[model samples]
Target: MIKSWLKEMEAEYRIEILFASETGSRAWGGATVHSDYDVRFIYKHHDVRSYLSLRKAQETMDFPAPYDAQGWDIYKAFHLLQKSNPGLCEWAFSPILYHDCQNFSSKLRRFVTESYSLISLFHHYIHLMDRNLKDIRGKAFTEKRQKQFIQAVRAFLLAKAIILEQKVPVMALYSSFSSSFPKDCTIVSFYQQLMEAKQSGELVSYADIEDAIFMMEQERPLLLELSYGLSKGKSIENELNQWIWELLHL
Candidate 1:
């Protein structure tokens, strides 16, 4: 059903969907099976969509999914895909990819370094951390909500690494109490004990704030440098995108 949706979209509308995420991948790695399948894409229409404004007509298709919605606002897709957001990069690297006819996914991969902004990515992770921490702390101290805390801490830890490295860190491993980072550094080990929690669709709690705090202190300086350096003049736009257009279009 999903495969045909791609052909129909391309055949009928000339719009191309670049990527999608399968819900199952999360399940195998500890997420609930009921997680939504998130999909995203980029497309172009017969030239008009490139410049149309509020007063002008638009070409976009939005439809409901079993667990989510699907649609495309053409230009927004173009810009965001061009910039290579981390979530989008994950979409490219997604184990279960939906469509790749135009070869945009691979091309996008080569240009990702240009799209990354340490400050922007850091803020994204920090906000997630704050929310997850609050949720865990709000719950009564018990093992019931352990899974949520674990997921939160893992997210926080990855963000912490990016802050430390001043780069978009590849996602790390996770369980209820402990998590690992890119290349599998076992900074914590109790993450291995969440097998039962995993089957029950749960996460572990993180009452130990010291590890997270210490990691942050060591990482702040690098993130500060990145934040201070992201300027228009410093944008590596031409070199990065040019490399993409010339090299990876197959």
Candidate 2:
């Protein structure tokens, strides 16, 4: 079904998909049985002339309903990559690949690893956790919304891990938490319960995540200090341009 849909998209848009994969919970290894496949891809147009026009081609495409499908144009993806866009980095490194141009994915992965900004990814995870926490604020926590709480915990751990390790956190939330916090810690057990609940399709109602939250709060000031001291990294535009030329067979 996914392959057929990709083919249909390629024909309809006159674009070649260079890389594609499953993202979100499924790719991050915290998915419930009911989780949906979040398919994301990077593609490029065949008509290079269109890219040179003052009016740019649409950089993204989205399909609603039936199955969630979305794609980013290669040009836009590369631009984001240079800025250390966390979403693009996640998509590039997603564990569950659907379709990928062998050379392109590998090259992009290496570029990201070399050029990634610890500060940028750290901020990204912090913003994600902040937003999730805000959404749950002043609301009554219940069994039905346990999934949201689990996600919040995951985001917080990822943000904390980025600062403590001075690197991008692992894609899997469980691994990120384990690596950051000791195995025998109560917080680890708390997170483990949440993970098991999410995977087993059970509600993780009202976990005592206060300790985790406190740790993040204490770490925030130090993280901000480190972020201010770091550089945003250099552009890989020349390399990306060459890749684009090769991909278009120009």
Error of 1 at 13 (Å): 5.7
Query: What is the lDDT, from 0 to 100, of the residue 101 in candidate 2?
Result: 78
Error of 1 at 197 (Å): 1.9
Write one digit per residue (lDDT tens) for candidate 1, span 1-250.
6667666766786554554444232523655555555554444444453344656434356555643435444344445555545555555555556666467667655555446665666666666666766775545745545655555545556665665555555434122323334435433344444444655765444444445435645654665565554422235455555643443331
Residue-wise C-alpha lDDT for candidate 2, range 57-165, written one tens digit per residue: 8899998755688899987888888889888877878878889876677887788877888778777777777776677655776544566666666666676666666
RMSD (Å) of each candidate, 1 decimal: 5.7, 2.4
**How does model 1 fare in lDDT?**
0.51
Give the residue spans of candidate 2 off by over 4 A.
Answer: 170-176, 179-181, 205-207
TM-score of 1: 0.64
